[model samples]
Target chain A: MAQFLVEGRELVAEAARGLSALALRRDDAAAMEACFRALHTLKGSTGLFDLEAMGQLLHAAEDRLAALRDGQASTPGDIDALIEMVDQVDRWFDALERDGRLPADAGSIGQAAAHRIRDAGGAPVMAEEQPAQPSWRIPPDFDGLSGIAIRYVPRPDCYYFGDDPIAITAAIPQVTALRLSARVPWDSSEPYDPFTCNLVIEAVSAAGRAEVEAGFRLVADQVAFAELVPAAQAGSAGGGPARRTLRVDAARLDRLADLADDLVIAKGGLAELAAQAESLPGGHALGQALRLRQARLDRLAGDLHATVGRVRLVPLAPLFARFPRLVRDIARSLGKKAELVVEGGDVEVDKALVDALSDPLLHVLRNALDHGMEEASTRRRAGKAEAGSIRLAARVEGDQVVIEVADDGAGIDAATIRALAVKRGVLTQEDAARLDDVAAIDLIFAPGLSTAAAVTTLSGRGVGMDVVRSAAASLGGRVTVTSAAGRGTQVQFRLPVAMTLIQILVVACGEERYGLPLDAVVETARLAPGRVVPIRAGWAFQLRDQVLPLVGLGELVGTRRAALAESQRVVIAKVRGEPIAFAVDAFVDRLDIALRPMNGLLAHAPGMLGTTLLADGSVLMILDLAELVA
Target chain B: MTVRLDGAVLRLEGSCHLEDAESLTALLQTSGVSLVDLSACQSLHGAVVQALLALGPRVEGIPASPFLRDLLLPALLVKRQAKPSNL
Candidate 1:
């Protein structure tokens, strides 16, 4: 299905990112494993869809990566060559997605990848004397499976959710009989979700059933896994029975849904016609027959819609798989020894949400590593464990999902923050003196309030945490931080289950009405123009003795100032860590609508996040407050 | 040096300058040159000596010039003694 291919492409991109990062770090093992995971998934999935050209290229890449993984040979040059091969494969996948056909010269890239693998052996030992093809099969004598045989069946569209099933399965130690399959039949006419992966792996290992289940805990729902006892009559053969798994394209799935909806409407019309026919004399038999046919058709269409919807659901494991390397690199860069503990990785959300979460989660993890955790020496000096730990736990909280990033290191110092607040003039000396430690520590969220005296290239410029907050908020998510001095910092983000439909508050700025994301709006108030007072070159109004900066909506959107009225309403928006009040013409009612980005050149307009259509058929520009501040 | 067809032996009579290719060529016209004694010869040019060396007659040296005799002759002798087919 199209979803499968999309998921494969994402995996390839992720793998490419990992390879490039590792290539920079000179970590051969991790780079090779990442590459192998990507190519292996592509190869297996492509085979399922009978995409021969793509499958071949991926298979070649898999071989090359496998060689490096096994330490048969590896060098910086080899890594570069392999990375290039992966990039080419990515381009091919993109082209295929755009054109629905493989490129004419697709085999060359695969050939190049294979050549690198052979060349890595250094001066080919003449063809006749070369060793036998490296075996991919599990050895017959190897019997490490003392535990149960658990089969993991990922939903067919798992890939679109950014879950790399092969990588997750491979991470399970002593995995035996790993097989990928589709949950349903492949229909070229039907649209499929590319994110869905229906890969079932029958793994036999020394790891307990709970551990095996826990290994796939992040994708447990989408993955249908079962523990089975090995039959004594069976031999040591690794391959599982071949099943004809269904593959469908995504466009077709959409068409099918539309078709089903149309059929439902038709059935409704038939039901009404049947009632009319029954009212006529001697039409009872015809009415009964029409109703029976309508019922059957309705049931079929309902089943079709349900099946297609299931095909769209994918587990989040693939996206989660990419984070271990990210955490490792970041922790190493910060000179902090921290282990990433991920939970609820199997939790399935909509595929689009999973993809959107990747960057935000990465930013959060990076911030946790750079600013949340303290160095080992510092931790030891503070009488804490030398090795710090970061726990990234995710769970379904009601309709929303909460991902919590907790780190154990030197926590936020409230006194330092209070001093910074006074220095930055965000709070007067008198006000700062009255603030408690908890309130003072919140000042860290203030833009440009960094405790570090000197800014390093890695972090501490005071821009990272703000970016993290903005990114999370953009997805209708809120991030909250709790820290204790000498203890640690815990940052938790609560995000919506899906992004297609969102509730937004529409506000009028000038002639144009804009939707200020409800998540970012703290409150709105009416302020008289005369009440706006000057504070340190910036105009601020004294509300509760706290000076909040006044930003005019007209000025922000490049509109001419409107004539002053008796009273002006200012929408106080929290951006980064600072509060800025935007003067708007009037408040508009809230609406729930499908948020879509504007087309044409206007989509690139600054401070405009996206565009949405209102119930009255008018377009509303969604304002990005963070962009405005920047 | 002059030799009769009646199996007569001829000896090199005087010092000959290997650098003088014209004289060597003129000498070859009158008599079949044999037993070249290069011991007293000094500063033999490569061009004139190569001509004589290719004349297909056994070469005897009064001793070659010191630089040429030490550096070039041993290598030339090895080449000459080696089987051309093998090379």
Candidate 2:
């Protein structure tokens, strides 16, 4: 039943996409049929359960789509109606899954939808107006390869509408068994109305679903049709899509990841044990055996860790799909027109990161619409197209997934940003003057800085770009902002591909050790005395031809530092595409560790990632190198 | 629902559920012939389908239900051929 609901949801979503294309000037029959198939499949799946209301709605939707496919013209409102129908169905399914039943008024709501659909006819003659087709009648002794179970409950007053329930049930094709059931317990005890239907005609037919449904077309809303598989095969009869995907409890996946982490730590212990055993006299034999076993265990643990990580990997399509509707609705409300273009949305990322990303991406996109993009008149004056284009693109770059949200409108004015920074007291007047265009634009990410002349409903609610930057940083990513005054703005969020166990370059500040994620580490340098250039707040390392600003770890994190030495260990990292180096007291061993996020109040703390235990039992603080540099 | 037995012939009516399977199997075992009239039987549980297959009953006046005629008839015929011939 869960699988049926999932497949039904997906089918509705797919049909939504198909409907979008069809309504956008597509006159092809294939588009109509695609929607028909989606609705038909949903109806069949709904029949497997007691969701008669869902089946009825899907049946009507299928009929409407079938009419369209048969050369009937359609109205634009008809497409909107279909889309609304799909949305309602999706919500109903979600409610069903969440609450174990549809909302209390689902039946009435379904009836209203049915009426709306019936009125949305595009045919020269309405399907309902056609002479009532023969209700399916079962033929005695006819053999059906597969059985279809049906329960028909026509409206009590259906006979007044010239509808006969028995005639309908008897018309079912290839029936091997039939029953008309009536029980006092299953009905009201009031004296039966001879004119009203108190009968529920259940039948088993061997005919195909389409035929059976066609036979009961008049009372589809009041009927339930189940395709019965032998009890032996019923366990597998839920259908094909359910067999391909599985629903796993999230807690189990987390427990698996935690156990994998324990295995890694245990493997590390075995290695330490092997090293200890190798030193004693006459311990070589035991040490050799332990080392060999430890090596195998190391490989097994590595495999387990990677497999556990993949379990959390899901495609980014869900996140990407919501943006189109968002942009459309937001644009319409703002009295602007914009089209959202998504590229490379098939990239897969850890589900946790994707879930955490929704708010940040929403903020960025809303910001693009409200603050970044110019009004239609302004865009036209700037020699750009009247309709603004916002493109959300993503791709895997090295070990990072870089997602960019770009807009074509009047971009940020760096001078205005600088002036705003000073006005907001985020930067002093003197510092504001020293800021170049790049530096001025970077201040957008500073907390409490907003250039909005007045607060707007869409974006300027006190929460600014700083929130987006912090959110990206929480995912071990950095947001890079760039804009040309009249061209547009592009904000890129470069995030780690996976947030599970990661390799880090462990380095020391003074007595405290910090780990730098290896993906950010371009190279380590041993700078000579002359190779260091004094900067305003720190030293710059002159490596080859590039002059990279070097931040002293001790000063950066407020830790104690050793006295200046003739040489220093520095790690050069790529932060927001700029090469910056950080000086540490000494370099430690590189290792793979599972870093969990800091808990409670410490969670909001910036710059430092979570900590993990070292082999020697000390905790290693992992620094968000990008945040630290910022 | 009850089965009416007369000599080697029996008639089934109304709806017969799975609980009736044991009695139906017993009747087929004792009754010497497999001709059971199901013309008036409106519904049969899936267990009845399985029983009909195992018992290999020669049902005369089969119920006039498309589902029963189409799905169960083919299944019943296939089951009868494979029903060990002596049942």
Candidate 3:
């Protein structure tokens, strides 16, 4: 039920976005269809769950949107008013979800929304004014495909203003084919009408009837959808016949995986006992039996783990779906011609990771629009196409998901960055002069850094990139950038597949044990004080001419320890592209463990990533050297 | 001020601003009227519409007036209905 509410809230928010987009682009048929669909989903889902208040409010808003879709209103102000109502409805739903109760005056908001819908046409004199009915026609054979069909007819007067029926029909998904025919036969004696749409549509779609019907809601009076079951052999089947896959609830899959993990642990303990028995006299037979059992358990556990992981995977379509409207809005706002291209939308990742990536991706997109993309006139002058392009691509690489946002726009100017850095005191004049273009470009990620002369609401706040970097790091990811002036710029974020279990390198500082992320650890070495060389104000070691800072692990972690003995070990770690070496007493083994949150106050302590329980009943603190070095 | 009560008809008069809305509420309370005509009024504020909405009285006025029907009426209806009174 909580999950259902979360999904419903997300749908409402999407509907609000769609409505706002329609308000911004008043004549956009697609936006209107999307808005209507969102509201319809919200209403339907609320009704299904017996959320009467939410359902009624959304129903009222949906009615208004339906009128607008049919061309009863032709003003941006009308669309804005409807959008305002949608926004209020979204807020109400959010409030209900948060507080578990509807506001006392929730009904009044619905009443006001209904009135606004009425007023969108004109003021109502009294209750006697009847809403105009739309004319609709049903398509033949609509119910032949084992699906439902619905018909909507807009009043004949609908097209007199500005509604386009074809645009609304395009929003429905799973439409295998669409054939629209005039409702009234074309006749030379009929004044050769061009504006009136008396049309019947034949569409073959697998999408649910409610979703398709909702798309046509604005012209619900003039639109009709029918569900039909396709013939058993309509589509070709490979490998004998097509098989239906079972859809298991995620919670059930998780519970099963947990049980499997417990079983694996028990098997492992049994195997250890068998090995101990073999170490004694004449226990070889027991060890062999235990080995066979351990192998079988391992196979079963591995398969179960893989199945559970696959169950948590979700496609990237939801993230990509919102970009079209975003590009339209941002391009219009900036008065620039820009197009968005998405690739690898079917690539799947953990659902939780996808949710976490949303804000960072949005920030990058906004930055691309505000600062990366060049104006149309400037692009033409530069011998490039007038319309710039932004490409978003996602793919699974090794164990990480790499999402890249690249744009064919005027790239970042290194000189400008260097000048800004000098002006902002982030870098000295000498340092700025010594730095190359690539290094200068990286300065953009520095906190409180921007080359823009004036900060706009959309970008140039000097905080976005820094936040993006930190957010990526928190998820055990890193963001990198590559730019060539006048060509383009591409920003890539590398994120882990999951946050639960992480592979870490365990090291010991004095008597305490700590785990460093394997991804951040450069190398482990045994070094004496005599081998360390001094450079600048700090001690540095030369490995290929690049200086690495030497930091004592005990001092870094504030561990009480005596002076270092003659023989000591150092573990080199990199944090945010800078390398630092931590001097430790010794290096322990590495293992993959489920990272649990640290206890109370230690959770917020610096240099600590999380905590993990070991097999020996000891707790090990995972160290985040990135945070420490930063 | 021009005020009239003929059987069930209640006539409102003069400029009816937000300040005068309270008096209208008092009049409605005393007279027990369910319908009111505001055509004689020079002006009406959101407060007047709100008061009428709170009193749950059917109102009649210029139908084509954008301010009265679109802005004032809708806003008042929204506010009053969201917060219902005992009366």
Candidate 4:
């Protein structure tokens, strides 16, 4: 059931994309075919379970697309109806995922949706509209063929209305042979309107009249059907570099990564063993052999870690593909015109980040469409294109992946945000007034302050941008916004590419070594004696133009403070953009290590980010500088 | 534009919509186009297909769609075969 829901959601998304494409271009046969196939597959999968309602709904939708592909005239609301059906199926998928079965109302919902799609004039022709016309010339070879015969003469203006007579006849069920001829003798000397429909289409299908009629139901007024009697003896004529994928449960991947991390940690023990061997008497050669084996294991462990990381990486395309339909729906609802332009969907990130990003990204996108975009009339007055454009882009910068949502609507109003912050009591009037435009814009991330004047269904619940901020922060990322009035607003989220492994600057104090995330470390400096002056009980250090309050790492972690030395190594770190100095005994080498969050009794340990195993099998504590300083 | 005149051959690619019909007719009339390639075309709007049928241009290549291939190739060729002077 879980597997079904996963793949079902994917198939639903595929169908939705295809339908959207078809809605934009009715002649997109590829999109129509793709959507039909997706629904067909989804319906078949539903049959594997007891999902009758979902199956029925998908079948209806599949039939609708099949008819459209058959050159049926699509009603204006046909694609919308199909998209709604897909959405309904998606909701049922959600229900199935949450519970083992769909909601109790699933049947009614599916039935209603299926009815809408079928009754929207997009349903397949299930019955003959009229008796077969006697004038259809039966093929001589089909003398004994047992089937339905069809002859269709489309209206001359049918082409202007988007009818394809040939496609309609070709779609007849079990079609054996087809023939076409000009309805009227062509006058070679006369120039004719090319768009005029002049062909008479005929086909012999090896199916019942009702089934055959369904294929031409859209053009039933122009088609006539006949029954062909079978002549007893009639015969019918008839990678490069490949990448294979297996869909494994995300949990299983997480487990594999955890095991790989354990292997990497366990491999550290070999180095310790090698060192111990060298310490023993007359064990030099044994130690040398052990060291060589340890080196090989180290390489293997590194390879395993790297490979697991690669395996966990997934493209962002699927996530981005979902927003086009959303943009359409929201734009329609709000009476605005907005287009979501997505780029860099091929950027690969860890599966966890991708999953975690969904809600936050969705909220940001909703905010962009709901609040950032202006109505078409307003946009025209502003001299911008009537349709507002929001560009959702992601790119890899160094080891960090940056996802940015930029909108060319009215930029965020800093003055409004400042006033809202003051009104919400998040800041004093003086405080709000004192903030610059950038700082005022940053206030959007302040909890309980919404820039929207009214709370609407789409957004403006006052619990929006803050959530985006915290979600980014939780993922070891940061969000920043920049806006220019009448121009646009750009919100950027800078995050580490992967969370499994992190680079840290190792430091030592009082015979204990600890790791600090390299991002937090501003600079490492050796301060001469007296440069560090005592301010009250705490210490202060002069680094360039700033006087930074200093804390000894030993005392901070509840260990004995190191005695003051002639020259002290002070590590300057930034916590919440404020510089702070931590006095350390020595600066150790920097390394990339997989951090294991504190578990067991140490799970709630404050100031400790996590623990990592060193090459010598000694455990190193990685400090959370921000929390530590706070 | 789904209808493009490349050299002397008119190529109909992707989904050729109704808007392409006028250009298709224009290209066939003035560009001294010799052939219509539907190989890359997924489907053509009826008007565009009609334009092809009316001009009676020599068409080459089959679309990926079986329904289209079955219907269009024959309609284009059968019309010419029935009245060779129409071209």
Candidate 5:
């Protein structure tokens, strides 16, 4: 049942996409075939369970679609009607997911929807249910045979109507070969309904046509008769590479990832043991052998961790496929013309990142449509295309996935933002005036500072870009905006390719060891004695004739301060822009570890990114040096 | 009774009516009956066939009635062997 819901929703989305394509070009045979097949398959699946309402409705839709395929001219509303039918099915699936059955009024609602769609195609409303004939070819096993082929599809309520279809088929004279199948595949996951007739009874009878037809006299309306003859086998198409996938629960994958992480820590412990054994008297060979074994274990554990990460990678296409219709509908509703061109959706990223990025990407696109786009007349006067274009593109750059939503509409006006910031009391008038153009434009992300002159139904409610910015930041990513007057605006989100596991350089402060992100570390330095001079704020160190501010890592976390030694070992990291030096007792090994974000009491703790487990079962805090020094 | 236990096999000895569906489903569900014999069966109501299709148990014999033997049995057995497709 759960699988049905999942696949049903997917099929609905597929049909919607195909219908949208047909809406643009009715001559698209591929799109028409795709849409028809998805709906046909969905209707067939409905037969497995007690979803007779959906089955009947989809059957009507298939008839209407067949009429169109038969070269009947389509009315203007034909495509929209089909799209609406798909949407109704999608909603029914949502209800099925929640209540484990459709709503009580599903029959009436589905009937009305089917009527509307059929009417769009100028077809008469079906007053009495008609059993659609199953398009079965002559069975290949009955080659070179001559008989009357019968296919009987009983109505679901035929039992209540006193119709025993099997008895009718079995009573045929001179019956030679017979086969039975459900009109749709049966789903064992759902409880069976004995009262609903779900059988398709077919048989070959070696009798005159009149005699065969006479046998089904009681249920003639539900039977189809064909002359049995040799059926040429349809040639099979070449198969593509099989990519069978397992639908594992994401929580299970996370558990596997956690186990892999534990293995890495346990392997690190072996390294520690090897070092201890090496320092003992004449135990060098044993220590060396242990080191070799640890190295091999290190490679295997690393490979396991990487394999798990790869397993978690999901293509961004599904995340991106949701937008084209939304963009079209919003454009139509808002009386603006905009096209969303998406690219690089085939690039795979962590599944967690794909799910998290959906809302932020949507909000940005809405903002573009609502505020950035100019009217057609305005665009015409400005010598731009009448229809605006919004490009939502994603690409992998090094270890980060950069997604940008750019619109060719009126760009962000920095001066207007500066003025609005002061008017909204988000900044003082003097401060607003003093802000640079870049900084003033960034004020769009200030909470409660919306530049929209009036709140529209779409986007511009005080919670706008600030939410996008914060969401990106929570995922260890950042959002930036660039704009030009009368041209356009682009918002880019730079997010880590993987979020669960990260590389960190372990540093010791006094007796405590902390982890710093390897990407943030510029270089390590050993300072000569007396080179650290005392400044008013704190300690200052001269590096290449530039005095960089130095702070003890222990002092920042409110732990015991590190004592200045004869020679200080400091890590120079670039925070924001300037170089800052952090004094540490010693440099430990660099390793990839799973980082769990701080929750509960320490969730909002400043200057801390997260924590990880060390080899000796101790927790090591990983600091965000940029946030730490800020 | 149309349905009764014959040794280890559940047998349908006569025509099974619509009302027999409930008792057949209950017996299949409770007794853990894995094999059913239909040699003496004459006719099966649509409801009875639906129960057999739903609560599938291995069958031991074919009924004497040509309709139950040629049409209903094949339908029930084919459905039992095939997995749900078109997903």
Candidate 6:
């Protein structure tokens, strides 16, 4: 990923945001003006660097926007083409960054994209969107027709299968004519079923039959081709978003992180020396001076972390922007009228977190749209709006970022989940039946439990709710689903804002020390023996009226036997939703440590989440409660 | 297909397909007030019709093919939809 230069990523990401902003809110005059300035600035910047082709291409795009801004002409209102141009430029920039030079075909690519920008500047003509109907009619036969005639009928569940028909058709080579129409009748516009696709697309292309067919090979069976007789037909043309970034070599940033870490360790060592000096005869004054210097070092370390974090921070808009297009297409595929609403797209998170979050979040939204979101008719019948909505929202919660994908559709039924759990052999019928609603709902996070009845194109290809849960967990985060039968489902992912240099609560268990995320530590308490109670096979301690579960640190980590100490010493940690008290030898001082995820064979070691180095040069194994409790 | 975007007019020669719709629309958009000369056009794809319709360009030199002529003229013929231009 580092090979893709940071500057290239920044340039592409910023341009993509601006282009999408213009595309999405064409009516927002301010956003449109910003887009013009951004494009113009990018063009001028590229020209300054002597990237002639890029500068020229962006100039053309800016010209169109200039016309729109000047009110010289109406905006073309084609978001797809504008997106394609910026996306193409992004690829070109990637090639330039990787090879230290632009590809030989850069000129042609830019010229082609320039034409698209022009087209995108055209006025709006396509307004009414009729639902797809079964169109088996022979493709239009026109005079002097000299290319391949194609009729593509996408599978009703193509969206589930992760196939985008719009993109596929839009990318066809040498496209001459494309007619996207609904094959299905408009009987129920009051509450349209968007999930049920009744649309068929027929296109005429100047591209050869083979090129077009190869492009549609994913759904070959759904396409029919009619070859025109030997005549001169024009050939096809081709074309192909990133985030805000500060241009810094990723290697240098890594080195800075390492140095900051080393400084933190060195600062700890100085404090130790200060303590030793304080013990010396007549060393009290010297010790105080060294402590002041150590305090300065600590401040510097924090500043360094903040600086590096800002350099790596990126707005969530680029990530969130991708979903609306996806949900819109998938909704169209399912014939379900679903709209994606995004909030707090301007919220910034670590770039690495954004990348890590993309795939799993996509999967969760797929489930939300397919299984979680009910049909329009069902929604209407349930006294809900006909148009179901999914929102991709993000916010900063303390030091952590909370990203949520919420839908206003049919929510999960715990009974259905339990039944599936039993049916899928995930749990015994008796066990599933004994589980409460929350526990049963959590069972969806257990692998192999898909509520979808059949393997459709959109989802139910075996990867289930547990996959979504595990993905969040792998990022040192947790996912929770709260649903009401008729309401929608929200899968919230709570993750630390930064992956490096987090504050951890160090604890000692006998001879060994371990680290736990400070955020997870609710409180530390020394309880009396009488407060500990045995519940079933496990032990619980009464915190207030509620009894929290208790786990022995020595027993959970398999290091030592649980000693029957006279006093119960413990730290209360939040595990899932419940607070669990873990008995430890003693609580050590809290320290800001950079935890490195355990890799290779030890990565999946039971109970260990990650490992961090202490000032004393010893390794502290961070514990994962899910693994510890299991 | 040949696309000429410079000069006082944007020119398209030979047969053009739906795939070229974006390029053609772009040519018209970036061309500003330049006339889209399609007189040498042997055939025009359906997507191009929509692209041209959106732009409402002054399409010069209408093609001889009835298939294109019928679709092209009706869309560009409506003066209310297109800008005032000499036919």
- Top candidate on DockQ is 5
How would you encode candidate 6's per-residue C-alpha lDDT over B1-87 as one tens digit per residue?
555675877777787654566677666655575577887777654445444544456667777765446433543554224344431
Better candidate by DockQ, 3 or 6: 6
Interface CA RMSD of each prediction in angstroms: 37.7, 12.6, 21.9, 2.6, 2.2, 10.3
On the 0 to 100 scale, the lDDT of residue A39 in model 6 is 59
Q: Write the per-residue lDDT of candidate 3 for residues A441-486, one digit (tens) a residue.
A: 9887888786556787777654668788877877778898899889
Candidate 4 matches the true fold with a TM-score of 0.66
TM-score of 2: 0.60
Candidate 1, residue A506: Cα displacement in angstroms equals 6.6
What lDDT score goes with residue A90 in model 5? 73
Clashing pairs for predicted structure model 5, backbone only: none
* Residues A1-630, model 5: lDDT tens digits: 887886677677667777878888876655665677678778888999889889978887887877775457899998878876776777788689899898899999899988998899886644432323436776554565555678888999998888876667667888887776666655768766677888877778877666777888888898888654322211100111233356798999978887888888889899889998998999899999999999999999989988888888888876776676678777888899988887887888888899889889999999899889998999999999999999989999988999999999999999999989988899999999999988998999988788778788888555679999988987889999999889999999998887556789999877788999987889999999989998996999889989999998888877886678888999998897788999888999797888877889999898888899888888989998877877
DockQ of each: 0.00, 0.04, 0.01, 0.21, 0.27, 0.02
Off by over 4 Å in 2: A1-12, A24-34, A40-60, A84-125, A128-238, A374-387, A428-439, A484-487, A507-588, A616-618, A625-630, B1-87
Q: Which regions of candidate 4 fall more than 4 Å away from where they truly are? A: A122-124, A127-243, A269-291, A321-345, A375-391, A422-436, A455-464, A508-513, A525-529, A555-567, A585-589, A597-606, A615-618, B1-87
Which residue ranges in model 6 land beyond 4 Å of their true spot?
A1-30, A33-246, A328-339, A374-388, A425-443, A484-487, A499-510, A516-552, A560-592, B1-87
lDDT of 2 by residue, A22-120 (tens): 887546433554566567667778877888888887777777776665446676677767776887787787688899899989899898887787678
- Give lDDT tens digits, candidate 6, residues A488-573: 78789998778667678888888888888888889999988777887886678788887888878888888897754668889998
Model 3 docking tier (incorrect/acceptable/medium/high) = incorrect
Query: What are the per-model C-alpha RMSD values against the true structure?
Result: 32.2, 14.0, 23.7, 13.8, 16.9, 22.7
| Ranking of all candidate structures by their DockQ, best first | 5, 4, 2, 6, 3, 1
